[model samples]
Every structure is written in C-alpha cells, then in structure tokens.
Target: MSDPIAARPAQDRAGIRVICNDHSGRNSREAEAIDLAMKVLGPQAELCHVKGSDITETARAAVRDGYATVVAAGGDGTIMAVASALNGTDCTLGMLPLGTFNFFARGYDIPEDPEGAARVIAAGHAQTIDLGAVNGRLFLNNASIGVYPAILKERETVYRRWGRRRIAAHWSVLKTFWRFRRPLKVEIEVEGQRRRFRTPLVFAARSAFQLEHFGLQGADCIRDGGFSVFVTPDVGRLGLLSDALRLAVKQMRLGEDFELICADRLVIHTKRKRQLVACDGEKFLMDGPLEFTMVRDAFRIFTPPPGDEAAA
Candidate 1:
C-alpha cells in the first residue's frame, strides 16, 4: 500500500494558509474569527475567503502554492472540505472552530473559540490522525443518510430564517421529525458479511469524542481503528421522535433504540439510484451503494501539545 503521509514542503519557503467561509453555518462571526486568526498567525500567513463549493479546490491551490499548513477557519463543513483536499497531501491541517457545533475541531482538542484555536495553530504541533471516507469523500466527524440528511436540509432553511444558533439547529431537527415519513431499506455489507435493514437513519461515526459527548456507545470501537455504524430501527414517526428525545437527554439505549455495527469498512446499498447523504453537517445527493472506510494516520493536523495551558 502507498504511504498515507505525503512529504512535507520545504520549511523555508512554505508558510501558513488559512481558509474561511463566511457563509458557513453561522456566518456573522466567521469574519471576526478570520481576522483573529490572521492577527495570530502574522502577516506572512495567507487568508482565503472561499465559497462553500470552492473550499476543496482552494485548499488544493494552497497546496500547489507550497503552503506548509492550511487552516480551515469555519465550521465542520469547511474543515471537511479543506481536509478532503489536504488529506494525504503535503500540507498540514489547522482549525479555528467558528461554528455552532464544531465537532471536528473539538474532537482534536482544538479550542472552540477562535483566538485559542489560532494560537494552537501558531504553536505548530503536528499529529497524524485517522479520517473516515464515504464514496471517496473524507469526513472528520460523522456521515449519515435517510432522516439525518433530511434534518440537515431543514436545518439550512432554519439557519437562514432564524439565524445560526444551537436552538435553531435543534428546532430544525424537530421540524424534520414532524414531517418524517420514509424509512430506507438498505443492504449493508461488512467484513464479507451482508445484512438488510429497514431504518430511518444509518450513521457512521469516525470521531469517538462526538459519540462520547452525546452519551452514546461505540467509542471504543472507533478507538480500535474502526468506525461505528448506528442504524435506527424502522420506528414510525412517533417512535423516531421518542428516540430523538432520548438522544437529546443522553438517555438513549443501545440495543433497544438502535443497532450498532463496528467495522473498518462497509458498503451500504439502497434501492434508490440516488440518495441524500450528510457528512460533517453538510448535505449532498450521491449515487447509490455508498462505501464507507477509514484511513488510519492519513491526515496531518495541527493540535495543541499535551497540557498546553496557553491553548486551553
């Protein structure tokens, strides 16, 4: 197998490149975060304000421009887009976590606030981490299909109407459930074994910290070099709502509410030719038969050192 780590760029020439999307998740504060990052990283660092669709290409351009470190300064979606391009490439990844959830950045012990996160990047402590991929696209937190993607669609609408806030995100979930009607019939294959499931959602999780934070099980499986797959039983709308409530309260039961499948790789097939998939809080339509896999030590990320008081 080819080595996952790419050769680092020459230190003397390569510099830091920070990418931000003001329109991502909660748009208003992204500008402030970008300004703070630039101030912290100094004038030599390059700042690129990119649109959502152009994030990956911009990160690629940063790599081609010989940047040593490319920082994503928005939410999980921005981080995922930048990582999709920089993963297995010469540039190191950094984060500013300027979003509502900021799961990907928090998972790496990066600070949620912009200034603290920027200092972590300035410290330049690099580490290699595993990344999950579905259909050849990388995701830092988790990916899901079925009701979750529908919820993301609703969330976007809600963000536009109510502005971006945690309450708005939760409200969107409630709205999606009230209108939820369909369950997916999928064939999931893992480790040469195949099984069928009728479920409202199939969630594949890559970040153990996210699962643990939500009071969910399967983190250990993720730490063991595999991703955890959660399939919600084909519960009717009311039952699904009940599960959502349980999850919100961190009282969700494992076997009773959802089935958990732990594997290094898996393939999911649906009857539909195309399905909406949500990855790291971004939704998109993808062709069927989604394959999910994990690449261990694949991406180099900038993180704070152990017990770093300044970053904390």
Candidate 2:
C-alpha cells in the first residue's frame, strides 16, 4: 500500500508525540527505530521515554500540551494505560507494537515492527474503537478472574527467574494450575439475567480477535455491543489440564469445555471482599461486586487501512 503520510504535507505530520515504555521488549532497539522515525517525520515530532507507572500521566500531559496524536510504544499494559488517559478525547491514539503478543495491535492490523508501525502513524489514518471497563478501570483487551490472574501472578515470578519467553510463560501456567486446584464459587449477572457457577475461571473479552483465537464462539455477540464472557464449568484438575491443552492447540469447543455468555453490563460477586483481576496482562486487586461495562467508539486510534500489510 502507498504511504499515507508521504502524500500529506510535512506540516501535517509535525503535531505528533510518541510516549515509549522504557521496559518494553528490546527497549534499545525500539528506541533507535522510534528516534529515527521521529527524525524522518519532522522536527516537531517529539519522542519521550517513560517508566510504566507514568504512562497515563505522561499521555495526559501530551494531550494537555496540544499534541494532535499521541503514540503508545510498548506492550498491552502500556497501551491500555495511555488509552485510559485518552478515553473520550479527540486526540488520536497510535500503536507501536513492542509487546509479546500485541493482541490489540494485531487485531487492528497495526504493524509489529516499530519502524513499520511508525510509518502507519505518519500515514495518519484513524478509526474509532470500543473500550472495556471493569469497576472504572479501562482495558483495551480483556479481563478475567480465578485461574487467569493466578497464572499471571505465577508468570511474573517465572519471568523474573527465567526471563520473558514463551516457554517461561507456559511453565508458569503449569505451576499455577498445579498449585491452585480449587474452583471458585461465584454469582454472575449478565444483562439482568443471573446465574451462579462453580468454575475454575471466567474471562470477559472485548477484542473479537482474541475471542476467535481461543476457538470459543460468539464474536458477533460482542461486535455490536457487550462482552463475551467465558466460564469454565466445574471440572477436576485433569479435566482442567485437558481444557488447557485444547486451548493451546486452538481446538477448544465452547459447549464441551466451557460456556459463553453475551451481555452489555456484567456483575460478578465472590466471597472475598477484594479479588485479583487480570486486565490485558496487568493484575489489579479490586473490591467485589466487580462491575464490567462496554463503551462504544470511546476513542480514536491510528491503524493501517484494512488489508494493508506492514511494509517490509
């Protein structure tokens, strides 16, 4: 595809700012590409590095500084933080995928390479997308409780010891599953319909691509509005392990292994006063009765036009 920014005048690309996470994958390499891209774009195109904790405030400051576009250069967590800050704003959010999965970026067809994604940002095509929220905390991907959050907690420890690789992530999952063998008893309300469940996990997905990836149907249910909630029925450890294996191989069937529900507003209640919830790979200890809602066209994002592959 032709370069979008190349067709536009140089002055039009000047009002862009890039906020990069220093801890993202291969930070040095990402920084080099981003810096080079900024120089190519124009003198007014600014780049700044920020710690993960400061991404939200830094993005808000960029908006306050009158930047027309703010690019998030990191993983899903970094992107979500910046998105939370830019929610309901006119400023466009640009993605420079530098994470392990880059689910949100890939779903939107954003390039994985820093330089290629940078070119798309320079091209400046923007689209409106939905946002998911859990108890006021916004997320770009999905949120979950039970086994999902437990796996993330274990993944951090394994990541620290073995480095962040796919093998280490899988190892973490095995260890978490072996350690946490009990199912959680909970009540869930979806679109005013209530059901109680004894399950190993419950996942609420906003990204249709992610839902399709797991082989769990119902992407169309959430395409218009609402979330696709996945609940794993009461199963033994061996059964749970079998389900995990199916998910790994992309062979999971919803009715046999889990249940899928579609709802605009969901309320989850657990015995504990506070629970650890995982949202887009980040874990948070939030108070119960967890409330989830979907907001349509909450923000604008710069993405590659449909069917346009990243430049090699």
- Candidate number of the best lDDT: 1
lDDT of 2 by residue, 257-289 (tens): 888888888999999899889999999999999
Tens digit of lDDT per residue, candidate 1, span 67-134?
Answer: 88888878899888888887777578999887888988888889887888989988988899888889
Clashes of each: 0, 1
lDDT of 1 at 148: 94
**TM-scores, in order shown?**
0.94, 0.90
Worst window of 10 by summed lDDT in candidate 1: 1-10
What is the TM-score (0 to 1) of candidate 2? 0.90
Off by over 4 Å in 2: 1-14, 26-28, 307-312
Cα deviation of 46, candidate 2, in Å = 1.6
